[model samples]
Target: MIPTTDDPIGDNPALIVIDPQQTTSESEEAMSSGAASIPGGRDAVMENINTVVEHARSADIPIIWGKELHRPDFADYGAEIESCEPEHGIVGTRAEQFDPILSIDEDDMEPAEYVIVKRRYNFFHRTDIEHILRTYDIDTVILVGFMTNICVHYTAHGAHEHDYAFRVAEQATAAPSQDLHETGLKCMRYLQPRGIQDITDITARLEEYDGNQLVKRVKESGQITPKTGPV
Candidate 1:
């Protein structure tokens, strides 16, 4: 449901952008069929990702960009390394890079915003995300990014298990097919009734984020700065 005037996404929310670097910016058509393929098109989904990111940035919400990086020798990928067709997020490959469409380091972007690298489908596994969230007292997680059925789905599960109230920008995430996309949303919704919502609704809630006055405390602890002002 689209949140009405009052937003339940909470005041201490962090926007977790899961693998926006699914493809190189040069391959626009990868949205249809490729290792980077994302159903419902690529550019539009990416645009939504950026729009929500900007909203978070403007409202002092934390933006955690999850990058699925693997070792060059594939030793860290586990058994998938020996699979005939393995995950494409191998560290040195273009598939593991941030899409060129993203402005990762812009003047308007906050200096404290993070790019977190992980090897598992779930961000919480072997990543500093939980510690980071705890450092900032973040209790709410809003997810947006590529492959709704894969990384996004598992990350939502991780968030749920971690006891963080989470929501997924349903329209902001995509999969290789519409079936998978819808199924992914259903799974998340099953886990948390209000977990699936539109990006517009999510951003509306995000615009209300004022750092809950916790930003200063976290920064003093050397954890992270709550975004404020123009960034």
Candidate 2:
């Protein structure tokens, strides 16, 4: 459901952009035919992803970018080495870097933090994501990026297990196929009723984030003074 005026997705929140890396030419051959191509291609969701990023920036919300990088020696490959392409997301490779089309900047990692270096689909796995979230006092996370069925889906499970509420910006993510994309969203919604949401709703909630303090004040003291000016 879309967040309402009363049920705003308040409380401190962070944006976790999962594996927005460049796909390699050999990547398509590693997947089955059913999962070989994105419905409208990856660029279809780029606009939505950028829009969400813009809104998150304007709201002053912390933006954490997740990059999947595997060691050159393949020591971190584990079970994935058998099922996936070895060259995918290799360290020092273009695939390990964020897509230039993204709105990412050095400031996002200004203090040399918030960028999650992960080797697994789940960003919270063996990464500092949990500590980062706690450090920022973030209770909710807004997810956006590539492979909605893989990285994004597993990351949502990780967040749920870590006790952090999350919402997937439906239009801001894409999987290899439409069916898999919908399936991923369905599974997440089963975990959290309002987990799957539109980009519009996500942006709207972010724009009103400053009002969260007012909500907290009302709950703490049974009274609220109307503010006539900007929050």
Candidate 3:
């Protein structure tokens, strides 16, 4: 929930965007094939996520992107193929790369803006993501990504286990159906009751965060100077 006063999301936050790679082109191809798509288009959901990413950038928050990269032979996918993506897990294919809107180069992604490539749904599973968050001093993680019932859900649980606060960008994650999407959010809320949040509310708080950073910068510089935006 957003605060009536100051909000932690507006300051020193980390935006964890998971698997924003599936594009409209891929979705179209999936429809032609036997695979099913979650309710509400993935493209629309990613648009909301991009808005959050830009705001988080302005607020100087770390943006950690997770890309699900797996071997073509399905050696690293384990049971993931049996459940989902049996037809969808090939690498170097057209759908493998991130979409242009969420493209790394277009986003001006820095080396410091961490990108986690994982063979597992949970970013923390056998990954240094926990240590990475600690290095950045990321207190809370604002999550937005694909497969609400799968990757996003497990990642939220991972955040809980790691003792990091998390918020779900409800409009920013898509499942195969509206029911499953809501169910995923409900499950995440069960882990952290107040963690689920609307993208609109999150964006509003991010806008307010600009002034918060400005104030702090002035105090440190001892004079007014132009901000290069959040570091």
- Model 1: clashing residue pairs? none
Clashing pairs in 3: 38-175, 38-176, 39-176
Across 1-231, the per-residue lDDT of candidate 1 in tens digits comes to 123223546547888988877553444443332222234466678877888888877776667998877787778888656644345676666876677777576344354478889888898888999877886678778888866877888999998888877788876788766777778888988988888877778877676656644554444554444464785
Better candidate by lDDT, 2 or 3 = 2
**Stretches > 4 Å off in candidate 3:** 1-11, 23-40, 106-108, 210-231
**Could you arrange the candidates by lDDT from highest to lowest?**
1, 2, 3
- In angstroms, the error of model 3 at 124 is 1.1
The TM-scores of all predictions, comma-separated, are 0.80, 0.79, 0.77
Candidate 2 per-residue lDDT, tens place, 1-231, comes to: 123222334367778888888766667444222331234456657667788877876676667888888887889988787764335778766776677788777454422125778998898898988776765577888888867778888998998888877888887887766688778888888888777777788899888777334334434453345454677
- The Cα error of candidate 3 at residue 190, in Å, is 0.6
Q: Write the per-residue lDDT of candidate 3 for residues 9-109, one digit (tens) a residue.
A: 63456789887775444545432221112334766776777888888766656678888877778788787768744455357764466767774662554
Regions of candidate 1 where Cα sits further than 4 Å from its true position: 1-8, 22-40, 81-86, 106-109, 216-231
Candidate achieving the largest lDDT: 1
Instruction: Pick the TM-score winner.
Output: 1
What lDDT does each candidate get?
A: 0.72, 0.71, 0.69
Candidate 2 local lDDT, residue 141: 82
